[model samples]
Target chain A: MSRATELVLADYIVVALYFVLVLAIGTWFGKFTKSTADFFFAGRRFHWWVLAMSCVATLVGSYSFVQYSEVGFKYGFCAMTPYTNEWFVLPLFLFGWFPLMYYHRITSVPEYFHGRFNWQVRFVVTLILLVYLQGYVAVNLLTIGRIMKGVFGMPEVYGAALMALISGIYLHAGGQTSVLATDVFQGLLLLAAGIGVFLLGIAEVGGLAEFWAALPYHHRFPFARFNTPPYLHAVGNFWNDAMTATFAFYFINQGVLMRFLSARSVREGRKAMLFVVVVLMPVAAVAVSGAGWAGRAMVERGILPEDVDAGNIFVAVTGKVCGPGFQGLVLAAVVAALMSTLDTLITAVAAIGVNDVYRPVLPGRSDQHYLTVARIVAIVSAVLGISLIPVFQHYDTIYQALSDFLSTVAPPLAVPLALAMLWPRFHARAAIIAMVLGMILMITALNYPALVTPFAHGVDPSEGYSHMRSLFGLVTSLVIAVAATYLVPAAESAADRLTWFHIPRPRPARRRARHDIWHRRFRVQVVPGTDPRLHLHPETMKELDLQQGDVVYVCDARWWLGGLRSVHAVVGEPDDTLPRDTVRLSEEAVRRGYLKPRHRVILEYEEEPIDV
Target chain B: MGPWLPYVYVYGVGGCVFLASLVAGVRAGAIDLNRPADRRTLLALVAGLLLFATVHAIWIWAASQEPPVSDQAAVALTAETRA
Candidate 1:
């Protein structure tokens, strides 16, 4: 069989159109990004649905399609184990870490360490996190390059470089805003194409019943065998994929954290998290793995050759089932998956570089200077990511490479992070020791697989012991952190706002009859003041039920921007000189909110809660 | 391994993590289980877990019962049609 599959002209046209559309959407959002905050977190303005959808795009990495489909063909529905098992972490995330990060406005994981512990902890974490994020970028680029080679007969390096260049262009243009916007579009396309492949495959096989009959009995099981298969056992995958990797993705992945931070409110962020795990993930599991399942069924029925390469199962199946233009569309979805994830990781690296590395070393720089630095870092990050693609090419399978990489790096950082968030008694000294020791131990396990044998849970360590390394790392790190915390003297106390304890609860709204009149929109003017205050006409204040010293949320009338053009301010003494139809915001508030000088704005009572 | 083993492993190990996080949240005063909203949320999470487990178990059982076409039979059928 030929290494490369043939593609018709229609396929090229569809892929080209997809590239143009994504670029257009990304660059269009560029105009809205003015400051570092806007560039990194999209001005904290996205609605929950947008964040949720964009997050789904990021979560379904390009490697997800190639790797999961490869496994789906070989194993069966067990390919979905990673996606299905994320629900267990939802409670910890929503109740513990989500609010901690959101309310405290922690921009990066390293920044959180700095705030909760000390500079030493932050510096240690910053290095590990940079390696992890850049590695993630490399994994994505490599997968897309593999796809290009399988379908278009292109060299892997050139394909990887092309993808990196495309992702970097839009990320440089608009940053997080562009990433969010383009991801939403790509997320939908990804789901549609994935499901479309399965549907088309079903038709080719005669019907759903025929498809089911075509799969072998052993392949129909939902989980892999318990422990016999050293490489892909249920027990080993539980520790590596479900527990360690998933925890790292939500807790420490800077890209995923930025999605939550970009929410308009904490409540919206919670909604997005619930929707992602409960609704989107299961669908995404099917979407990403459907091609492989179909391919397996087709092979069983002799619709395709039985000797089809497992690694190229996705491309083989798409070529067999999808006709001309439709084939291109499916390929575009693969590109969408790669680009969506790559852009997020690239932007995240930029945020970490600027916030954690650059700003601390050179404090008191202008926002513009930092913004320029962020853009430059984004370009450099993409370049570095492309360079690492060659390193990952040595691994036998994409699944093994990604799983081994995440399992090794995630547990050490994940254990320390969980301890820091949940256990206030966890000291800075303990964090530093645990993180350092954890790395040493994990690296030792890489060199000496025997170290992981004890934690392998009866699985043979001879073949694929890497998956069990996470369990070993976690146990060792937890023990070291606990022992060190008690043995060492504690330093200064962590502020209540930073820990899970003493998270500020929202106060109940005032007891009063609500009226539609309070929803009135008013024209905003920049008052000559430096304080963060909003001035309202007496009648307007009375109508909105606002009082002096009350915290009010003032936002641009164009609600479609979400909360991008919004700010919270203390309501000043009513300005009798102002017109009833207008409200005046301090110059500082206007600038902070990115509010237009003469634009109409709305005001609502913001029951000021005690800061966490 | 039994068909029920995967579910057992998932909930058994995953259940510990869930409970530990819940206990930590309650201890931190971040999650007030006494509140109606909090209680409802906890219940919903438990229900969702059980629901997924039930659906997966049913799928496995149903799929297991379907008689698969033998490889030789499938290949023979294809060859016959081609001839």
Candidate 2:
């Protein structure tokens, strides 16, 4: 008798154990929350490192594993486009935009909209976010089911419900705490499994050089053919992928923007982002590309039948190469990844319901009631997600589904959010109309892509770039938003340029005879988001007794607080009071750049307080 | 699939347990579950390690069963029929 193989049974048991562990964790967190904030955003106490891992867990899902693996199996090394796109999103997140979030104090994208435009703008942005998020939620549910079917041989419907039930119960049980903390665990597991599978795959194929040699020429090199049609198609596809992903909403993503606000210091947030960029993002390359290589190995090994669907690529590879115990572990990792992303969407959707929907619909509810309602909303969303999975059963790829849904509102929102932040004239009416028009044009182009052939011109749509949606949406949103802002600028009388935080309590504002002078001194200096210990002068900050990154406006124009905006934070001089003892240095001294000593230069602004 | 991975996830699992205790309160109305959550955290981690190792073992066996990648003629023949 063949020895009873414990492999498959062990794998199932392991998957079951992983789920049970997740459930237990959720149950444990369910015991106590200090307050609603603890439930919602971990009391905003997560370190940057924690936040970074959570980000990875959120972005690197089972769908992505499958998406990349399929690409690898089909195209060999040419399957690097998505990996290339992942790299492109990093700099914008790391260097270009997120630092502003640490400086500009706001909660929720809507709050920024209110500051720049009005309540109308906030509503529009919220609606757009919901629309974009819904698609992601639906697709994730679909992925959960497909993963079950492929890896465990569960039926599609049962798999979908299983995911919905498991994710919904735990998500409702712990809220953001479960999502965040579990993400860290999930991210680590997924990363390690991915790297192991890839290394083994490369070895199986006799290393990278040997693998490349075995592949056909075009399969090994994707972009070698540079004809006009193909080249433009490639260029546009790359831009669409990067630009849409990188566009800052208000200033940054709410999930991550909150990390800075919760940061103990600006230094912590900076370090946290740096850690992610340096450590985690590189690891992500292994997951995406390694899965691809594993896919190729599976195909070449004849483990995958010729008739298998492209979507089944990862499932086949993982099943054929990894034994019972490892297969269960790998399957669990896939589920973890899928759940990691899916839970983020569910939490965000619940927040919308809690803050934006339930509270408004029934206002007098207690905080306890609000919390209960939030949990219910998550469960409801999961149910809806389950219902929607069947519709996408007809679609080809999960990642492609993600793109189609996201591409809808990205262009309109990207333009308005950026413009509203930098340009004061970006008014609400203009924003609303532009967003609506951009969406309409996008849908039209997606349906009748031929209408966009002048732009896509001889490019094939079936290759699935969906260029018409991205390009047309971009053109329409920019044109409409910019024109509306310029042509119909909001009434000067209607717009207010003050913030609640800046509107000081008058009693404190008038306390000292030197108040006017102090206000004038602090006029041009921005309240930096970074901690003085990290970004400001050593001598001056030690004595101030003020919190780092807090807005401390004195009367005189002092360069010590950094640039025109709080984001450009660095120390400029030693003291606002001591002109003689002052260390006069270059402008970079006040912001994050090199400072060379130069003759002192000063900026001018109003000394008298504007009517508050 | 080794011992190290479960170690990496320890912090995350512990944190999740601590967080989930609050969810139990919000849902069923009483949340003195932190004690049990802590216990579960350890159990979950141990279980996870075992699971990963098992999957790896299965993968090795499966790899042995599949035909070698060097069978070029068979691959070409399959490709022809699929097309």
Candidate 3:
């Protein structure tokens, strides 16, 4: 009997419960998503742990389960190459990409482009982002669909459509809040299921000793295995394609960037990235690759048939090892992996579409209008994703296809993005040229590989093409960017705010005594938004002995561990929204001071204030 | 802590992961164990872990079942090895 046919009612119950649980989370969080900020960015209130778990879940999609298993079936422990590559790139991301997004308060990757480069760069990059993310979403859907087809005898297209609809319902209702809230559970589910399957598969295959004995010598060691047909050579592909491309993923991918951006503070963002690198990634590496190793052993032992497709190895092994009750949970976790990634991508695509594309064209629309458009874009993204299923259907394994797609597309954009931040002289014109030229070269290389590599001899010339493709694109992009930067006049002012060197450093405060003539008092009020300045009522400003043009130094009520109390220099914004007794501080200021509302603050202006 | 110890270790690790997730959620204020509203989310999470652990236990039992090797397949394997 087929494994799907053997599924008991208990397994079905578990799967049904998981779906209901995720939907309930979506419905509950929908109440909080009243504004664009709440929906698109989760109101930037995600704690470090939530961000960390969500990043893990988002990074390890259903494709990770299937793709890594497929590679494991073919190459055993070498399946870990892609995941272990994360360690080398994690430190680079922390010091380089993490700060660029966190400090700039960026909402999207393209927004960083718009800030540093020009609208032209932003628009073009957004198009590239849409294609990449949309394709990524579809690949995940195809993976989930294949699993459902194997487990339930469902048609692949229908199953994919159903999953997409399920994801869309939640994403449409609550947006990123629903995505992050559910992601915590989904992340844990993925890890538990991954580990559970590995342990169970090992036991079914007569424990680790017998399992290892069944495999050939080539599949035993992690690093010693040379590249065979239809696989990349470790030396070039490991560093160039795997490490460099994944660095681009962490640095510039919108889904990953959004998680970092959603952290309450840069400190939290850094902590979250550290969690992904130090704790979760190593476990993840083993969890994803173990299934395939077990499958290879079972094949050798005459249990599993040799005819099984490498891509189906994960589900096939799970079906063999897991009983009815356990089968349901494993299946649910697979669905969780798919939903977790698809929801994030759906919202990311919509976010970029609205913020970078639609809103720009239809500027000054009501928030309600944009919010409505954002919802429409989410639906449209899902539909487009479902339409793209046929494209992914042709690939032998999701990992190979994704690597090829990302290696070709990502370098063109990632090169220019890195240059814009690290090289301050990088001009807008140069960024546009680099992106355009790099894309053309990457496409040409992909379409015509023999022109690039004359020594190709494997049955599949494209076997180890990822690193080669990336090398061509990156080198061409850098050459073009450097040439264009020197050739064109630079946009120094635009580049200043975008680079790492220009991050705002808190300056030492000039303190005056409480009895000083410049000292003035106002009650502090908590305000929303991230601006650093203080707002004073026109009447309050008049009472405080201040004018619109006069500069005032505002200090927080109490001091904390980092030395002197909070201080911000501001020209008073006199507003009728405030009563004369109160001075309004942004929410960021409140957090900075660790202050309660209605607390008293001292605003000190020079007795003879200098007018700007 | 006898034969069940291996199972205990498996379920115990699963339990710890569940507890850690809960603690992380509470600390993040994504779930507040104190609030009645957040208590539902906590319950759902606990239920998921329990269901997962229950499944793990079931699989552990099944894996211990010692899958039968067919006689003909064993003969074919022996012949192939000798050849």
Candidate 4:
């Protein structure tokens, strides 16, 4: 057989074996994924070693291996710049954005979103995730497509379908366990393959020593680009613009957040994130360098056909450098990288649809039923995602398209989420309104870039126009809600905020209207206490029992155990009463949210009032 | 080279069959084709993957590279021209 035919047979055997292995893994590990939480996040008790390895494996997906490698190989010796973008220390947890989702404190991070922002926002956000993750789901298929077509003349759809079959099946069955285990094993395989490429490429192109000596400049520093800015300024406007691309743009990334949220603790999530920072850096550097070296080696050797794209440097290196049987191993390893990411993307969107949207609409369902639906959703998503892969093949890199898509959607949700958690002043109504308006403005702004051209190049100009729109909505919504609150009497009682069913009837004023009337009228009495208007805690002062609409009075203030605690009262209600009337009656107070030490002090009145 | 190759041969046929099977399954109204696993099945899996990587892929890659890029004289002209 000719080389292409030999490669065809070899790739198929390995890919077939790869598929069977993943299926068997799903069969083995699927037993563990028995519940909603397990299906959602691997039961949050995933083994530490498994987590560390999985994280290492996960960072090597379709984009990192394919697009990132392409960039490195084509750029000559300067390919390390992209690796610099990978250096962040997992800021999701440090910023407290994930809360305890990965920490196992909460089952799903979006569950917190539901509590923080209300159900409508939860449904809308889930819709956005499902729409955006489609890019991620498709990119994996394309990565393997490049490998298959470049090496063996296999059609792109063949590779895509093969991926769809293998990953979709096993992921549908095994869920998180299959994903983690397969990722770790595949990660190690890919690493060895990578090292092979490096050694072989360098060996072919004059040894490493000669290669380094021949270069005009032997530059190895990752961050030297920072020292001398490209533009004619102190820090250079270029570096600042790129920082938005690499730094700020990364924080709201969907994939990284999903990975971090899978960890078992705040600290574990931190550990997992930090693991990527440590392991991925050198691996990435070497991989990119290896690709570049291969490009040079192939040209130096003159072995690549004239018809071949330089993007095939990796596949060419693998096919020519490795023996027939072992080419299968490289194929398997790369396919796994593609599969791991594709599976995660598909699984995430499915979980979003099943858990966030479908479950809420139909509140009554068995875990098994939801599991069944999750599998179905995964299958449909895979089909749709696979079909979309070929459409985006023209982009310079798959990740740019993915990133721009995320930049549009993630910014709209990120602002309202941040405000809900951090800003105690944010009301639920304001958050909902802001998010809705933000989504509309963002959709419009992203769809029409020409509208933003005047501000796009300015220093303070928002990086992505969608991000700018979200901020605009956040400000406008806050102002409207705060002003609206003042127009109506502040809800003086927490009961007032409660539903109409919870409101209390007026008590009888005639003490002897009937004998033992209280027993027949009401079973329980709610006592009114002094409202504490001033709460000074490191955390925010949240809504307690008393509202700003009630009659206000200083109930008591004293220093207890070296800490100041005070009780004030809403003495009266809106018979058009002021929030600060001691003479008013019938309002309740409850202390809530954060409290500082020695923060509340009561004033002592010296003499009787004029009414007394 | 043994059953793995012809099985792969059969797999190429089988893959077509599998794609055909997917069509058939779609016709059959089957949403997916996965099943649960047992202890024995799981162990077989771990062993297979280990063997595939350690023996098959590595042996092929390492043995093939033993000759190195030095074997190709055509590369010399391109290398010299670029230099």
User: For residues A545-607, could you state the per-residue lDDT of candidate 4 as single tens digits?
Assistant: 233323222222322211111122322222232222122222332231112222332222111
lDDT of 3 by residue, A418-523 (tens): 7776667788888888888887887888778764463232324555354545656766778888998889776554665676555443222223422342354567
User: Over the stretch A297-411, how does candidate 1's per-residue lDDT look in tens digits?
Assistant: 9998898898999988988888788888887888888889889989999999999999999999999999999999999999999898888877778765754655566666688
> After aligning candidate 1 to the native by TM-score, how far in Å is the CA of A588 from where it should be?
6.5
| Candidate 4 residue spans exceeding 4 A from truth | A1-15, A76-78, A81-92, A103-109, A142-155, A216-221, A224-264, A293-310, A387-403, A419-421, A427-612, B1-83
Minimum summed lDDT over a 10-residue window in model 3 chain A is located at: A559-568
User: Using DockQ as the measure, what is the rank order of every candidate, best first?
Assistant: 1, 3, 2, 4
lDDT of 3 at A578: 81
lDDT of 4: 0.48
Q: How would you encode candidate 3's per-residue C-alpha lDDT over B1-83 as one tens digit per residue?
A: 22234335434543553465455434533343454423543454355445544653574354334433465478889999999
For residues B39-78, could you state the per-residue lDDT of candidate 4 as single tens digits?
2222332343343324433433433332323444557767
Query: Clashes in each model (backbone N, CA, C under 3 Å)?
Result: 1, 41, 0, 20
**Candidate 2 deviant stretches above 4 angstroms:** A1-7, A30-32, A84-105, A150-157, A218-233, A248-266, A297-311, A360-369, A387-403, A461-465, A491-612, B1-83
- Model 1 residue A496 distance off true place after TM-score fit, in angstroms: 6.0
Winner by TM-score: 1
Q: Give candidate 3 misplaced runs (Cα > 4 Å).
A: A1-5, A212-215, A224-230, A300-309, A365-369, A387-405, A454-464, A488-494, A506-612, B1-83
Give the Å shift of residue A135 in candidate 2.
4.2
On DockQ, the leading prediction is 1
Q: What is the lDDT of residue A611 in candidate 2?
A: 17
DockQ of 4: 0.01
